[model samples]
Target: MIKHLRGVWISCLLILGVGPSAGWAGVDSDISSSRYPSIQAALDANPGKVVEVAPGIHEIHDTIRIVTAGGGLVGSGRIIQMDPARPIVRIDHASGATLRGLTLTRPEGRRETESEAVIATDTHDLALVDLRVIDNQTRGAAIELRNCVDGQIRNCLVQNYQRVAVDDRTATPDQGFAFRCIIGTGILIRECQGTLIQGNRVREDRLVATPEVKRQHGLGQIIKKNAVRGRIASQRDWDRGETDNWMQGTAIHVGSPETTDNTQVIGNLVERAGQGFDIHADHVILSQNIVNDALVGMKAMHGSKHVIVTGNQFIKNTLWSIGMMPGASSLPSRAAQGGQPARAANVDGGSIIANNIITDFGLGQTRWIWGEENVGCPIRFDHGQVPENPPLVDVIIQGNLVYDTGRDTLIKEGKPEVVPPRYRYAVLVESGPSAPVGLHFSNNLFHPGVRGISNIELKP
Candidate 1:
């Protein structure tokens, strides 16, 4: 068979050494310039080397710092281009690095803000493969693993990041795994530790803003300075003000809770953000993702624990398609603070919001749970003046499918009614008899289009 395909292409060109001279094996011992000229002089001419950055566009003007220690930094199909005015690569305290098939661009008239294209601080076992962070005016985050530890960002292609597109801060928020990124925010896990955000393609560009009017003159009309406020300021009048600027941000922004237990956001394909996955961290696991045109589609906040939102696919989100805020004070339990465990009470008893598919387009405001109150005293409060109602004790919302293209989908407001009494189930809650557990909403599937009350009762 053609001599075994020429002996498997000569053993993959002798395991990719393809010698005819191309430099990179501990930095330039030979192999005359095709564009090496600096990547920190090819890592200071091979310090703990294992280089191989061949292939085209290597512009870079500064910040390619790789304080090596033990091999691995391959970009065999190079294109590190960055000068987005200037500010590319910067792996200061490196340790076992491995950057493959690069292509990090930046120069669209570089603005500033610590102008970053790459910056892995306090590094440790790193691995950024198949990269391609383009555009870059001042934040096309292709990769920025700070205080790194065993890291790994796969198949990248983070685009136009004006703000956050893979910024793993790493004090240990699950450690790493950002697969298939195409067009920004597809990943932003803060503190780091075994994190994994799979299959990405976040899209943003739709928030629509500019339209407001209010006038009431039934029993209230006293502003006669030239009287002419007959209230005629319309964008079709009232119900057309939710589209704010498409691509508003966040296709993934897991902030960190001390490595939030084996976190994982699977199968992504979000669109037009203002919100599309902003999980806070703690044993999280969101599956089969595919959100569209978001104003808000998934916003689980602080104290996140043992969360598991499954089988996703929320389309046309003008607003609200799963939102849980849990976290106001207890100070992580009272004192642990930033690292965790002062009062450390989240994970409100095993959460499992299952099988999803929401489609709200009535112009926003679908679901929201604020919960906040933990700072010191008060034990518990959900706005109704303590009478034996503690607050979200456990959760589980099953079988989903809500399409409210027009008739407002669900809202439960909360406030200073004195505090203490939280229960709002939507379905299946055969009597826990205490008065505050509402929000169980069984079987789901509600889309008859509007009249105000697919589920709502909030006045505290």
Candidate 2:
């Protein structure tokens, strides 16, 4: 294994640009340190060649912009961001650009930023492959793609990408609750069509929400100013608390402005996350993923439609395993600017949640942080944020399984102790004016929780 890994490292080094050693003596590169003083200088001189970064630590204070067509970067090198205000790399309108085999990170104090380590905007056929994004902590996403078409992020590892962020919802009257500090995301995709996120692993190593860690970071504090001035929305039953651990952040967050479509999130693993997959797009296919030790397994909401969630596993989740709901963006006003079809209509449902498995319910790392009244349901469907929006409609939940092993395997360094699963029901569906219409459940296998199976009928 060590030999194989060493060989891989060497191969990646060669791909990125190795030194003029005996083994790499005859290889020719488009641009290298021997040929150019710096990467920017090489790109400035040759705007269309791939900047071959040498296999070592390269620190930069300003963003490396890639704007020309066919301009790209490749190397198994480490690029450290020295300035907190600037991104490590930014690709704008660089069609057919490629960034691969790179390690992007920031130094100790330089980890915090509002910008991403890598941001791609208005790019088509952009490929980010075999990349390692580590410890680039931020209130924003570690890797963000905006308005890009036909992009793919594959075989990437994003570790410790979250920083504490203040989520202020004071401006919205419907979302009166706010968090003083919340975690940030790993990968964020917005308005990107035909994007494929595959074979990636997103995890948290250090910013765990242990009791002491929460106090040390001043997290989970109540925003009294926002709470007092604005009335908390009636649907926000989960926000009733003095202080939570601020376990809020998605491992992969896709879409929000209600323009992104045709996304596929497949074959990914998200461990120790606040939320595994937060989907807010249209025509999404979420399949063959594993979410372990998270607060939530996944959720599809906010005008999302035709989402197919299948063949996934959710383990050791403290909160609900799967959630589907509507948001403020799902209002009918989103379908039109002045009573005409302007963009894709804002609507929810016509989605299928099937063939998923949920195990070890309420056994997450932060399981102790939540109370029985609020957390732990294997499947949940909720209502819209505003009354004017259409209710979640025409959904099918089938062939899913939820089983409790009555033990917590997440507790390391000890014998697995027998603990009853902490959950209300196998499935929880809200009922009201905003209740989902034409809901169907069939062929599901579930172990009864505190409240047995579900509250609503499941026939047809």
Best by lDDT: 2
Candidate 2 local lDDT, 282-320, one digit each (tens): 899999999999988998888899999999999988879
Candidate 1 C-alpha error for residue 288, in Å: 27
RMSD for each model, in Å, please? 22.0, 5.3
User: Candidate 1, 32: how far from true, in Å?
Assistant: 18
Displacement of the residue 377 alpha carbon in candidate 2, Å: 0.5
Per residue, candidate 1 scores C-alpha lDDT tens digits across 270-323 of 665556787766777889988775556785644565678888987655435576
In model 2, which runs have C-alpha deviations exceeding 4 angstroms? Answer: 1-29, 224-245, 333-344, 407-418
Estimate every model's Cα lDDT from 0 to 1.
0.49, 0.82
Most TM-score-accurate candidate: 2
